[model samples]
Target: MMNLILHGYWRSSCSWRVRIVLNFKGLSAEYVPVHLVRGGGEQYYAEQRRINPMAQVPTLVVDGRSISQSVAIMEFLEETFPEPAMLPRDPYQRAKVRQLVEIVNSGIQPLQNLSVLKRLNSEGWDSDRVQSWAADWIRKGLLAYQDEMDSVGAQYSAGDSITLADAALVPQLVNARRFNVEFEGLSRLVEVETRLMNHPAFASTRPELQPDMEK
Candidate 1:
């Protein structure tokens, strides 16, 4: 029996975060695709809702307990399987990783999530307008990221090693592209994104390659 079961959508950045972590840790899961769009989002359906009241993807069920939220799930995985150590051992360095992670998780992602965009669409925003809204917020948050990277830059988001921040960043960059967010002058970010996207841990988890994807 598979010990870990992940409930996620192919294109969801939050779900992508967990997927990258799973791959980085050299772990495998029974991937249960919860289509976020079909049938008005399978996440809202009673079955998935029973696992995650928030009706969100990236829910990991392990040892008869369900864990929601991608960051929370990553933390759980870090504690249980700490060999590769997605976080640093030093408390301060770990906090730095979390800091960059939050800039993506709370700062950027919420502004353009499926629910928020759906609300905007229902409020009579056209596709272009909705894209503009997403692009605007993503640009602002990524600007902050760029500034931080310029200050204490490294091969990855936090430092020389691949930390939780890098996991958060690559997915957000994908979202930026999906919404056509222009991040001109953010060369450091662009470089890091390009390198990670091609890395095996990141490449194989792309939305297009997922089992649930149609194209």
Candidate 2:
């Protein structure tokens, strides 16, 4: 029985991405809540910084070895528990899945994360302005995602099967809604998200259902 612990925040999209993979893979991890906003963000504390030098949520500690970043954690889970593979076996399909994952991970999430928003606030960006900024970037990224998906023309992000791309996309959609990003032009993403949300892995791991979720 390898010990697994997940340190994360309820509302973090990155954390949600990892949670989806963990649940989909039927892997259990003892969850430790790290409230990102309370107490000036607990992630900045020495304890969390030791586990993740980046002080980000969704740090997976497996047998005492810590791994940070949601994509890395998902990849680790996929590799370790390959029974329910999150990636396709075909090389081109795998690359396509990775490409979609990066659309959210690199292209969108970094711009709208809590730390970046907080930094914007410090620089005198009001809530409305910050949210507008976040929404614009999210829309840009998702539009690109949609363009890629249109080319693929599958049920999910990368393909018909639930790949790493679906895990990444669902959470970013949650954030997009939070920032009031309009979905009028993103019907494909909405349709895919609706389908994915019905799956047990996604439904069970939603932020609102988490023990640490705050209203």
The numbered model that scores best in TM-score is 2
| Residue-by-residue lDDT tens digits, candidate 1, 137-206 | 9999999987776245577777777888889999999899999998787778988888787788889888
Clashing pairs in 2: none
Supply candidate 1's per-residue lDDT for 181: 92
User: Across residues 1-215, which tens digit of lDDT does each residue of candidate 2 receive?
Assistant: 77999999999999999999989989889999999988998999999999999988989999999999989999989998997988999998899889999999999999998889999999999999999999999999999999987355578887778999999999999999999998888998998999999999999999999999999
| Alpha-carbon runs more than 4 Å astray in model 1 | 150-153
Best by lDDT: 2
lDDT score of residue 53 within candidate 2: 91
My TM-score estimates for the predictions, one after another, are 0.95, 0.97
Q: What does the lDDT read for residue 100 in candidate 2?
A: 93
lDDT of 2: 0.92
